[model samples]
Target: MAPRIGVVTFPGTLDDQDAVRAIRLGGGEPVQLWHASADLKGVDAVILPGGFSYGDYLRAGAIAALSPVMTSVRAAAGKGLPVLGICNGFQVLCEARLLPGTLMRNEQQRFKCSVQELVVESIDTVWTCDFAPRQAIRIPAKHGEGNYVADAATLAAIEANNQVVFRYLHNPNGSEHDIAGVTNETGNVVGLMPHPEHAVEGLTGGSTDGLGFLSSVRRFLSVQV
Candidate 1:
């Protein structure tokens, strides 16, 4: 059977459908996982797409991180489940403590939207194995709070562990170390500020580069099986 990938939808999530389409295009069955449900439906992988969950109240992803489904997601992720968090989803991951660091408002203090270029810094993670080291790809990024920051010790640890997954070719949000994405030590979870799902179709997203991320997971699952 093909890998069943779950795309989570929070109350304010806007990109779940696009994520679902990207998963199907990447040769996986897309399962819509609701925020309030604790069950994951036995998905092989999970994706938290970009959007303003819970109206970005208190913090971008703070509220959604406490949702019932996230409890299950946290547990599953602990057992080496593959999870990819994009944009606000990235914020959610951090809020849920699945990944390290916190996303703060952009240095410019304004929302930015652009087709951003990023360098694949690490391909060792399940979400990034399809890309070659130092490969450049363009993906759409739209966010008001996307600057990633961590404590000095945490940052040092992340660098020492080579956890950085993607780096911005031209820094857009003043993220420390030009980091665009990162993975956990186990490399089973990844979080990025860019919306890869939007970049899967050239006609709509102006680039097909993002498809590599989705495709990489499917290939990983196939190998695992």
Candidate 2:
């Protein structure tokens, strides 16, 4: 059977459908998990797609961090269920403390929407194992608060542990160390500023590199058994 990966839907979320489509194309079953729902419905993995969750008030993902769905996501992730957060979803993971660091407003103080070049830095995580380390790929970056920041010690730790996932080739958002993505210590949870779902298909004038992200999860699931 295909892996069941849940796509979370919070109020104001814009890319849930895109995420669902991406998963299906990657040969995984997409399950819609509501923000208010208290359980994960036995999904093998969960993805937090990009959007202005909770309308971006009280910080990008502050309110959504406290959502009931995240409560289950937090628990599931702890038990090694893979979780991938993109853009606003990345913000939520930081707010939920699932990954280290905080997302701040872009250094340029403007919303950036573009196809971005990124180098996959580490393939140790469940969401990135299909990628070769340092492989360059194009993905979509669209957000005003995509800058990632962390304390000195925390930065040193995640770096030392080789958790940094992607780095922007041109450093679009001024993220610290040009970091575009990262993973948890256990390699199960990953968060990135770029929107991989938006780059799943070439017909949409998008890069297909992002398909690897979704397919990697499917590949990860296949290896588990």
Candidate 3:
């Protein structure tokens, strides 16, 4: 059987179904996971799709980071399960301490929407293994609080560790150092502001660059088995 990848849907998630479709298109079984459920359903990998989780009530992903499913996610990540967190999902990963740095409101204080160009900086992570280092790709980005921030020391550490995975070629938001995505220290978890899942299908009107991300996960699982 193909690898089963779980997509966690918190209340108010707008991209759960789309994420599932992306997963299926990438040749993996899409397992729907609920925020309230503590179980991971034995999936090989997990994805946290973008949306206004918990209505973005207290910050974008702050409330949702505490969901029951996140506990399992944290545990799974510790055990080296690949986790891809996109957009608002990226915010939750930082909030949950699964990844470093914080995503703040756009420096211009306006929500930005655009088809962005990104350079894949590292293909070492599970979510990006299918990509070649320094490959340029286009993906849609829609968010208000997508400006990534961290203290100078933390920022330096991330760079020193080569944790930055994707970088913006034409930066749409004022993310620090043009950081579009980053991997955790262990390289198993990755979070990015752009919506790669939205670009997986050509019918959606863009290059199918997002397939590399999902395909990377499948490749990772295949290697493990």
Candidate 4:
């Protein structure tokens, strides 16, 4: 059987369907996982797609982090199950304390939307193993609060562990150190403030750089088969 990948959907999630489509396009089975359920449904991997979970009422992803599903996500991550969080999902990861640091409002105090250039700094994770180090890819990013920030010591430790998976080429959001994406110490969990799922189809515009991310997951799952 093909690897079953889960795409979680919270009440305010906007990209779960797109994420599921991307997973199928990448040749993996997409399983729809609900926020209220703690079951992973035997998925081999999980993806938290971007959107204003809980209306971004308190803060982006703040309430979503406390969802019942997160308990399973946290446990699965601890066991080294592959997990990918995008944009608001990335915010939830930080808020859930699964990954390090936090995402704050853009320094310009405005939402930004555009195709972004990112240099792949590390390919050791399940989400980026298809790309070579230093390879550059363009993906669309749209968000109001996407600025990544961490204290100096945490930043240093992240760099030292080579956990910085992707860095923006031009620093669009004023993210500290131009950090666009990062992975956990074990490299199984990754979070990025971009919408790779939106870039997978040519009809959407731009190159298919986002395919590598989904393809990387396919490759990782293939290895298990």
TM-score, each model? 0.98, 0.98, 0.98, 0.97
- Give the alpha-carbon lDDT of every model: 0.93, 0.93, 0.93, 0.92
Candidate 1 per-residue lDDT, tens place, 1-225, comes to 778999999989999999999988877899999999999999999999999999999999999999999999999999989999999899999999989899999999999999899999899999989999899999989999999999889999999998999999888899998889999999999999999998888788889998898778877888884
Superposed model 4: Cα runs more than 4 Å off: none
User: Can you list the residue pairs that collide in candidate 1?
Assistant: none
Instruction: Kindly list the per-residue Cα lDDT of model 4 for residues 1-225, writing each as its tens digit.
Output: 567999999989999998998888877889999999999998999999999999998888999999999999999999989999999999999999889999999989999999999999999999999999899999999999999999999999999999999999998889999999999999999999989998888877477888898889878877873
Candidate 2: C-alpha lDDT: 0.93
Q: Candidate 3 lDDT, tens digit per residue, 1-225?
A: 799999999998999998999998889999999999999999999999999999889888999999999999999899999999999899999999999999998989999999999999998899998999899999999999999999999899999998999999977778999999999998999999999889988987467999999889988889785
Instruction: Give me the displacement of residue 92 in model 4, in angstroms.
Output: 0.7
How many pairs of residues in model 2 come into backbone collision? 0
Lowest lDDT 10-residue stretch of candidate 4 = 199-208
- Judge candidate 1 against the unseen true structure and give its global Cα lDDT, from 0 to 1: 0.93
Q: After superposition, how far is residue 150 of candidate 3 from its true place, in Å?
A: 0.6
Cα error, candidate 4, residue 144 (Å): 0.4
State the lDDT of candidate 2 residue by residue for 1-225, as single tens digits. 989999999999999999999898888899999999988999999999999998999999999999999999999899999999999999999999999999999999999999999999999989988998889999988999999999999999999999999999999888999999999999999999998888878999458998898778888888895
